[model samples]
Target chain A: MSPTSSLQPLERVRVAVDCMGGDHGPSVTLPACRAFLASHPNAEVLLVGTEESLRPAAGWSRCTLVPASEVIEMDDAVEVALRRKRDSSMRVAIAQLKADDEGHAAADVSVSAGNTGALMAVARYVLKTFAGIDRPAIAALLPNARGGFTKVLDLGANVDCTAEHLLQFAVMGSALVSALDGKDEPSVGLLNIGEEAIKGSETIKRAGELLRAAAAAGQLNFHGNVEGNDIFKGTTDLVVCDGFVGNVALKTSEGLAGMLTQMIKQEFSRTPMSKLAALVALPVLNRFKARVDHRRYSGGALLGLRGLVFKAHGSSDAFAFERALERAYDAARNRLLDRVHDRIRDTPAVLPTAPDEPAAAHAA
Target chain B: MSPTSSLQPLERVRVAVDCMGGDHGPSVTLPACRAFLASHPNAEVLLVGTEESLRPAAGWSRCTLVPASEVIEMDDAVEVALRRKRDSSMRVAIAQLKADDEGHAAADVSVSAGNTGALMAVARYVLKTFAGIDRPAIAALLPNARGGFTKVLDLGANVDCTAEHLLQFAVMGSALVSALDGKDEPSVGLLNIGEEAIKGSETIKRAGELLRAAAAAGQLNFHGNVEGNDIFKGTTDLVVCDGFVGNVALKTSEGLAGMLTQMIKQEFSRTPMSKLAALVALPVLNRFKARVDHRRYSGGALLGLRGLVFKAHGSSDAFAFERALERAYDAARNRLLDRVHDRIRDTPAVLPTAPDEPAAAHAA
Candidate 1:
């Protein structure tokens, strides 16, 4: 067979996924897998997890199982992820991806809807990173006013990150945009307290400088520092930050969305006349719903990994899981990891200026 | 004259509002102000801007016009805040608040739906902070799960803060929560990256330590550290955060709420059948409409100030402005500032830990 790295057409790519992950786990993941398989006849999934769990997901002919002896409970601590990847579903999923060289299936991507920290640790240790990437950021697409979604990285990876790590996120995020949005070089923004470069923590200020220099050198669409309020405003296509802030921003957005939707449910229950008005406005409502539901885009792509590794939401349903597998297949077809590695390798390394000397020396 | 601070059940609390501060400034603010006065029988409003601008919404009284020489454009930088305070409607509104205090008319609150940074700077500098408090925080009351709201403070007061500042926010948030919810010494949460003591930035850690000692001493109802996700979960009654992160959290929450609500509206309208379900559930929909309409909670009490300072939404309708004034009256009557002072004063000064003895000595 041609080398597995050949720009494999969607039909040639195989995606390995954790059959049991997330709240809806098998119920959601299996159906989604079948749905994805139904559309892409050649795209197959090596469903990794307990065989007993797989038996219930019945109707798939193209996909097979890679049984995992153990399962990691959603509530299991992060420590378990590193120590027990030998048996856990997430670990088995990665092991299947790493087993690509043997050509058993040439698994191009690994997908799991598991505990986030555990996934990050596994992806980091198992897949490793691109040459310049010290940390692989968890990139997710957010809905914007422009009818397009933006990618944000470090969504909840490392709580405390260095400016250098943010720089790496920008590089990887830039590549992901190329792979996903077809943008030659998507604009990169450093999520900050304010738009002004001078305003933010020391790390942000440092990252701003690196991004600015990179922008000047024609690397990213470097849109100076962006405030948290600007994320939904769609000021830029890509936002980068340390996981601490990114996690907070993401979760805060989710919380607010949950709160608003709940409140909307209550408001619709109010008076009869208002309900009538809502009926008339249902079309407009659905447009808004699809724009914000995020179910289709729930799986976050782990950038800078050796291969495509998509983390579906732990609370994901089958639709969410299927969407993730599709994303993984796309990433594999696009050779996202190789592209990131190449782009990063080709770019002139950002050299240290006097002020950035210490940061340059700092390990991300 | 009796203190205006006492809500002795006056004819209606008169509120002076700067109508030219927000993006939609006059159009939205004008109508909102009119709507507010109409709903609340005892509400009176002084619309400050140019006479020409106020005419459209001033068909009836409860509202009068206060002409200003120039309007403070929203795009003007911070420098414009101080320089144009003499000519701007926002400054004019603050001046009205002070003038009313002297005249014993004491407009219950001066509401502004304008430049937040300018509003906060002008209000605090002109109004000054309350006794024993160094700064005021724009406290946001978010809709929580228990059919109630939780308060988060220092939304954008200061970018750089200290442990003392957080301590003060906890004290003030407590007072405001008690005022709004009748909850005594409400549970207070320090907004950190994680619930664990080991989590957060150095400053947050320091603040957490201070809060721990204070809580142990029975000063505030400190519930250790609360992650950003916990904010929407409504695990605590009060959340204390520095201005930078707090501002981001509050604005992000608001933006997310608006985005999601818009999405839900669109999703319910995707097809003819869904539209019919919406039509059938018209009354249910109307009930929901009343629930998430942000106009109802369009104002926030500016905590830690000597006098009640209220912030109406930038797009506040007359109804929202009226509610803001109402919130101001409630805050003042509840002795928000005085209660904060009392609690803070009663708590003995917390000394730095032995680990920071050298730094403390150096500062002293």
Candidate 2:
């Protein structure tokens, strides 16, 4: 029987959520979880946080509360989260996923809106990396011109990565798009300054060679090198880069989008005449805003771990947080972990050997 | 006496224009030059290209045609431009800046909308680097939230940069901003993934430390590490980064802006109701467009060069090319090169030494 065959269509998909992790605490997460349970009749949530904070969700039937005494602050360091806060809502939620019985995890997936460094550290400590994978990458969906989303990683986990690590990211990213988006063979693009072969630094050029070999071996659908603009152009289904570059690109886009929105608002409210004009243009502007709404694309998967985990924006409200829950539910329902395992297992020979020395020291 | 005092306020500012460059060649450049000469009574133009292509402006006084035999194709390799196209318009224009009369440069500045790599290669070989500066950076102006522009570099020049190189870029950028914007001490922010002290790659972290030292020594007005979004937020007057990151950030912003503009248009044209709404909002939309117009910020300076050279967008129209010429004229009029020289000279003790070995191999 298949791994997912044990559950019927009407059977519940269990999700462990850290309700006290984000800036809003239970205020945002509790409502989001309630909405998620209301929509997904076959899904149940294990709310992991202090009993006092989660008191509001006591009346919900499909949602159960699991108390955790400690809280991981938004600015807490990784060492503190990893060693000190063993019972943090973030950690306890991840633990539920790890408490496997007969080779099966308890919760189908776990999610949090905690400090990224702390969350990654706790998740990695609890679930550990999948076999043959050295690092876990943070993958997020970016809106493209085709009215679709492109998957880009590593968003900020592993600040320094090797050529081998980049190759692994490509395989994982490809597997992700294939599983979630239902693409048979997702195209992967290596993020670089220029599309030319002679461009970029030594590490990037070396990564290109490894990616080419994988494509030649039928491991991935490599679309060759792509510039930053390609991320929004939908030139490829997946874009892979080291965390440093990916984080900068992601944050830069956010900054620019925020500025543009603010500028538009300022323009419409500059004068009484413009305010009247804004009323006439309200429908068009609202449509444009809904098209590029950040609430619609709120979840980012923490890939390569043995168990599934999704990260929501720390400042996300009820609507945005609910989208994160939906993303986790979709990934769990689609057997994202199994798909990743199958891809990795099939491409054993194509995987590059990790360097003997640590890659961080050599990263300039 | 000041070098500029010889020429009074109404005296001519000689400009070497590559008439046979960009997509439209003479069709765009000739008209742009004519418009530029008409606006600035103290400006003279030396139209550099084959005489046949530049025949349209033959009868204009104060507009001289300098004949060049060959043309640098938009796709020509740097080697092709440097070796084979010896008498090309791009090279001849740069040569005008190098040809000194009584120890004074012939042209105040040269403007080109040619192949960037080819132009940079030719300019560097002909004019050479400024004293104490290694690689010349490509500096461009990005629109900020304050209705002003932030100067950013290196857009795509040096792909791999050392900590010392970053320090040089900061000094040059600060000088440029101070001269143009008339700020006593223009704030310089080093671009990175996080604002925290312990974030980013080794090169970036080291650059941060050096920048801090420069700040302590009163050599630069350092604003510390800034994230990508800070570029649009107007967090600093100048953002300095390695070419790879800067180029990706810049191109990504352009792609996003273009996509948003296209999406807005698509939304308006989708249905008759939205179309009518768009017509009502046309005034406000046009105002927004004028505020963030790319044509107004077309020129990017090749900083740290012994001589001044500006790169215009290859697809620039006459209006855009005229804006570029205006930018060059402003920099020349404000004595931008002299300001850069003064800052570099004053901060001799604070400058970092170039590493003994090449830094490219360690670039991640």
Candidate 3:
């Protein structure tokens, strides 16, 4: 759990930004990038998009315009992102993380607010997966009732995950939390219907066994099983599940929050008395909203990849996108990629393929 | 769909109550039953519990005390409820729905606030599944943004579901909604990660195909694939999914709601000024709270069983338990059983084994 690099002025953390992704494209990304640069003195940004599209950030300090010919729409299929849009801003942004002939990478990390499927496909194809990892997973922080964020992974990345995959996710998630949150050891909970070992599908039961074995071997801080409610209760530092379930939980939370917010607004505007009350309660309500705002937790790091890649919400505003940028910068500064490798290297018994698998072949 | 029985002076809807079930047991059940009886003059209640516990409701009008020797605790295992506690109140309540030698059921419906696993196991064993239904599903109403309840099924009934099981859930969910909500044809949506047909697991894709086939054959009002958020958005009248996913989604929604409620309270009570604002906003806040209260939406109907069985939350108060009883009563009065049978009988093409499978064999 040592820092990979000292916070020296000479060591600049470069983040490649996909300027033409998300709903607002440059409008959100540019402003967020500007704010991000203003805060970090020793940080650089590789603006990856069409030359004309990135014209606004052309003369910005410590910013490099990495030209990309095409744009990947939020609705584009995986095939379109992987094959047809080879020069997509997302692909070029990810490509900046690839090492050069002299073994120096153009960017330390990449961030995109693009379609999840497209980003995953493009990133996996360009930079490739890390050694011992069969598939890369989407990892994000969910705000919990404990007033802290619980890291959840495999969120819509690999829908049909195996028991071994769950164990891998646990290892990857632990590293991400340790590197970013600075928690040396984080407890991981296997998400299931019931806390009992016998509950859930065959895959889940098998996953529990693997996680327990990993825990016994001192590889993961496995915390038995947890229900969906446990995610918000902050019962564990990390909650691991298959992509489908994770995706559903994330979207369900969003949906419920949206409904409640609307309901509150509707209730306050129902009568003149209520309107007066709302006016009085305005400051308190705004403070409450800020505390639970999803924008503060906008980044979803793509774990198990050779290079660091992050995803922001497709509908992110400047504030939200800036949070994503800050998250990516923190992950890069904390040496997330090396931390993942260290965890995988140390836990070879849990991940048997690490030693034998060649880097290039594993990436492919 | 035609009514199985017209409202008449002789036609009294009887509901069997598992008085010994739930956290408060008789404390909650008795008051709920009393309120239910007062509301529906023609409705009779079969209070199934030990005679000692039922002594308080002894001479109540239209209330019959059906004595049971044992009680199933909230945390009792399914095996304990099925094998050991044969005469448990939960079992006895479900038994009241079984047809007697004279071909008449003792009760029209049953309600319990016991553990879900034990209740489902006992209900399935005693009442048996309906013909063509391989596994029973738990259907419940969730408050949606459109000011209506979205009927979601398989809320932790059968963990491992096949494509056929999902189709069965859709049919049963459709029946439940049509009967309870009085919708002639309720549109059913298959819960998935995305709205696209090819976005989920293999089983989901197959379920989507089967649903489309059923729709083409004019059996179900299939609304195609829906994301988890769609459930709250009121995209469809019914959202069908496997028990595992449904359970996770249900618990996740509960978790988010609880967190938001707590946050709102904390925010309003932070300071003297905030508390004063809260005093002013008390009426509006209470109104908003009532609208989104989960208690109003209590009761998960165990569908696909031969008899009607509704499950209240184990932690239900008198008001919440009453909601469950009312739901059961409405379901019974609306002829939910007959509706399910009619739907199953009509969609034989979608259910291949319905014509050939015997009731007893399917039950086993």
Candidate 4:
């Protein structure tokens, strides 16, 4: 058994959930919270939302309601959510994860199925970035061929990142997989157009050098540059790229997967002969579906923040939201935030040189 | 029937093949040439390679060998091929597509499965860009849910693209799809992080405005901003983006598809029950494979060049290279190059404003 498994039974993990968020709002989140509480006996939830809508979860012994009058809509602008809705459910939930009385965190972690832009804005404001970290990145788990998952960072957080920002992402991502997956030294692959060292933009090429220096210092297991295919091939445990490239890659894979699934079903049901074949293929197809299910990969942790914050899919159902909560619980129980802090603090600086500066200045 | 079909019966199309390129080199290219010649009775091939490799296809009535001394290795740098290997087979094949006597082109199109960088360098140096076009984009067909293909451009040609470069790609892609797919005004989607105008980088946002203006002027059908998923959903006939984003998206889809296929097979063969199920579901599986076969989508045309150039996958087998050849044949026979030139020339100028200039300067 792991250290986290031992801590899970002895201590209670306080989870602050934004109940008014997501597509179904309270209908989905309340039932998921009920289910989550049942499974995790030592877990408690502070459900933040409108009191009237969150009344369904009021009866749960382990659940408490933190009423907030305002709600951030799905399509609300970041500025509107940040300045206009100060006491919004999403903001209140994130605030619960902030440091409180006796220098202890009010909630171990916070999970929200809300507008990503608004959530990021509020989370950054409530729990500012960790020391030495410039910006927080959105890290998500993607299914790989190894039957395991690869952690990809900066999914859509920082669109235009410098080489130093990429190096920071690598450090944060390394800390993440190490804490959650129990890998002592996780391999980090810098996402590029090709595996060759000479490939990619000036920012990426410089980032590769920093990653190499970090690997040399035993800070990370740098796998050099990897192409997009390497992400699914599980060439490394962690992949790092700018938000623009990473977001495009993630969405493209989702789109292609959906198309292929639709095409497979259409082919199987096209004619009477094929329909008979589909009946026999049902079991195998179900197994395949379970292996690549998007619901299994619902949560994206907003890394580099001083506190643990996870963003569940905005359109998540009860089951999907539950998975996101479980992911957060695991991270909190394992003390992911502390691990990141320690890792970033201990590592020797690998800051990139400015574009106009001499290349010698970048040497650590 | 299309105008190309009418012209096919009266005229014979000459194609130049770089037989020394790709993984299999002469072995794959030779047999694919034989099959191509057999299918297109009104077509001839100029096989460019070493004299030793040319000996195998000497007996074909319509096939003529154009021997070249040097061969560009797959890993060779662009400068090496450009400055050193002047007599390379890939260079010679591209040269055949250039205008020869009486201002008439020597070959309708040229096909090569060599190093992409080297091929692009040689093609640009020999053929040059079309009038008013800055750079050539790599455009390929991707299978979509509509059972047809969507043409995507600038796969990896120009990494850092300006807004004006994106507009050029849009114009070129529109013309290619229009002539080959018979769409009078094919819809072009600007690949972005989100559909909202507020999302994406400054370059992409400006490109969107230019595209909208082009659409209003009746030069192309601009479908505003689309997420990566829209590429496979067939939301538009053509998707345009900078080389970095487009390359990452394309490769990620390929990687995910490959992983899914592997997982499906592994699941089917895992248990005795599943083995029997696999046997019964062979027909449906075959249909699924046929629908999403990567080999069927091998060729990516090097658009905006003065002469027509099509690139085959470096690792293509006989059948895959044949698909590339056939695609080039289709593009050549349909007068794709001429169509692109005409479309770009007739379209009203919607150039992007200079970075330092006011937004009002772009209202053309």
The prediction achieving the highest DockQ against the true structure is 3
Clashing pairs in 3: none
DockQ of candidate 2 (2 decimals): 0.72
Error of 3 at B350 (Å): 2.6
Model 3, chain B: what is the TM-score?
Answer: 0.94
> Per-candidate DockQ versus the true complex?
0.33, 0.72, 0.83, 0.71
Number of the top candidate by TM-score? 3
Q: lDDT of candidate 2 vs native? A: 0.84
Interface root-mean-square deviation of model 3 in angstroms is 0.7
For each candidate in the order shown, give its overall lDDT on alpha carbons.
0.71, 0.84, 0.87, 0.85
For residues B222-278, could you state the per-residue lDDT of candidate 4 as single tens digits? 888988889999999999998978888888888898899999999999999999999
Give the per-residue lDDT of model 3 (tens digit) for B324-361: 99888888877777777667767777685545332221
- Every model's TM-score: 0.80, 0.93, 0.96, 0.93
lDDT of 3 at B277: 97
Instruction: State candidate 2's TM-score.
Output: 0.93
Residue A249 local lDDT, model 4: 93
Stretches of candidate 3 above 4 Å error? A1-11, A356-364, B1-10, B353-364
Cα error, candidate 3, residue A62 (Å): 1.4
| lDDT score at residue A99, model 2, on the 0-100 scale | 44
